[model samples]
Target: MQYQAVVRKFGPAAEAVEIERAALPVLRRDQVRVRLLARSINPSDIITISGAYAGRTTLPFIPGFEAFGVVEACGEDVYGLAPGTRVLPVRGAGGWQEYKHTDPSWCLRVPDGLSDFEAATSYVNPMTAWLMLHKKIGLRPGMRIAVNAAASSIGSILIGLANAVGVEPVAIVRSEESRARLSGSLEAVIVDRADSDLATGLAGRHGLDAVLDCVGGAHASILAAALKPGGHFVHYGLLSGQSIPPSFWSSHPDIAFSFFHLREWVHSEAMENVQRAYAEVAAQIAAKIIATEVREVFPLEKIRLALQSTLPFRTGGKVLLA
Candidate 1:
């Protein structure tokens, strides 16, 4: 069968992406054939298109991070999965396509009561939020935690999860608009760019217990300093493309630093652990606690414009290939 997908070509402007027709992959033993419904644009997806993510994908690759689909066919050995079952197959780049054949081991049963959009977006961001808080840091109730880029998808999930567990979240955003947008979820919102008096923002307040940082640049040190002694700092992303400043270690000798990569979590955690994470994420999606907030949806034919329009710094929410 012919299928549609976005493909990246190599050149001086190698970052350019294009949509094309391709043959649907055939199913193999231990694999399932999926007809993709929707896929969300992620920062890692953009970096791969720009040829920076891992620098490992050969030229002319498909570009997608996550997708939700219906199983059209399954290998003989696969159990508990069959035709017409909705599932989310964990794959690297090919999820943007119309159909794919992936290992059945990677397909997680999506909650039946969720929309395609919600199922698609829930796997990555929500799972990351769950793993970071519950597994990576082991945050307890009544502890004070902070998050950078509070308006981001994962950051919002962190806030919701923290509040659900009775933990106070100190959300930091670079713009006033972000603070306004996220005002409902966070206990305290600070404008990172305008406020140099960050200590004053936490006045008459207890010390921070942890911090979830995505903008790993000069601000890493600033965020680290705000933490109480023995507080944990987890760095996940480097949207600013800046290295961690040296001062973070020198100025905060007592604060502990840790890195939380979703990729690493997926690889290191046992299959049961991963399944539990996905289950919690699926439940949140069903409850609308973790909603799929799509800023824009682009057809396969408009792949180039979609990528350009939703570059990380410009997009407000997750962009999807619909």
Candidate 2:
């Protein structure tokens, strides 16, 4: 049997991606075959397709980090997971397809009550936000943290997590339009980049304990400057297409700056630990303490259109393929 998928040829153009059909490989003894129901387009997907991560990504690859699916078949050696179980595949690639054959160890059972949209888009942004808050920074209640890209899915989740624990979240957005979209709807102090300088607006005002920054380049410097003395500055995204300047670190010696990637964290942990983390995140999603707001859902055939939608500065929410 065969399934359709979005394939990325070796190149940097949107045209590099094409829809094609391929035979489904047989499952290995420790593997399971999944019928993918939903997947989301993330910034990392765009970056990988654009050749930014070319050194790491092989050509003619499928470019998706996470997806939700149902167990269609399991190898004889596979246990615990059975046919018809709702699961999310937590792998490095090959998610933009109708079916996936992967190790059962990489699959996490989706918690009951999460919609396909919630389960499909669950791993990357939510886990990044949750781990960064709980494991990396050890954010505590009553502490104030400033988060850039406040309207993004991860940013929204960070706000929710911070609020749930009594932490004060200050959302930094690029424009008033973004500020308006996020204000009142989320519990946080919203700052518009166009109206005021981020450092001046946040530094002396809030006594910020940390800056959870997804926007790199110049914005990262501003966010770093906004951090209170001895605060942590965590950079997780390079949406600006530029890396943080090395000079910023020397200039801000009192602040600690670190880069975060979810893959590294997952790789360092045992499989059982990974599964536990997924279950914890699923519980948060079920409780609505952390959630994804999808901007659009497109069929797998319209992958080009879906990829193009993410090119805009801010489309307000996640774009999913179903």
Highest TM-score model number: 2
Window of ten residues with lowest summed lDDT in model 1: 5-14
Off by over 4 Å in 2: 6-8, 183-196
lDDT of 2 by residue, 130-181 (tens): 9988887888977778888887778889888888887757777776677766
lDDT of 1 by residue, 94-146 (tens): 77788888877677788788887888798878888888888877978878888
Residue-level error in angstroms, candidate 1, position 143? 0.7
Regions of model 1 farther than 4 Å from truth: 4-15, 194-206
Query: Which candidate has the top score in lDDT?
Result: 2
TM-score per model over all chains: 0.91, 0.93
Q: Quantify all predictions' global Cα lDDT against the true fold.
A: 0.76, 0.80
Q: After superposition on all CA atoms, what RMSD does each candidate show versus the true structure?
A: 2.3, 2.1
Model 1's C-alpha root-mean-square deviation from the true structure amounts to 2.3
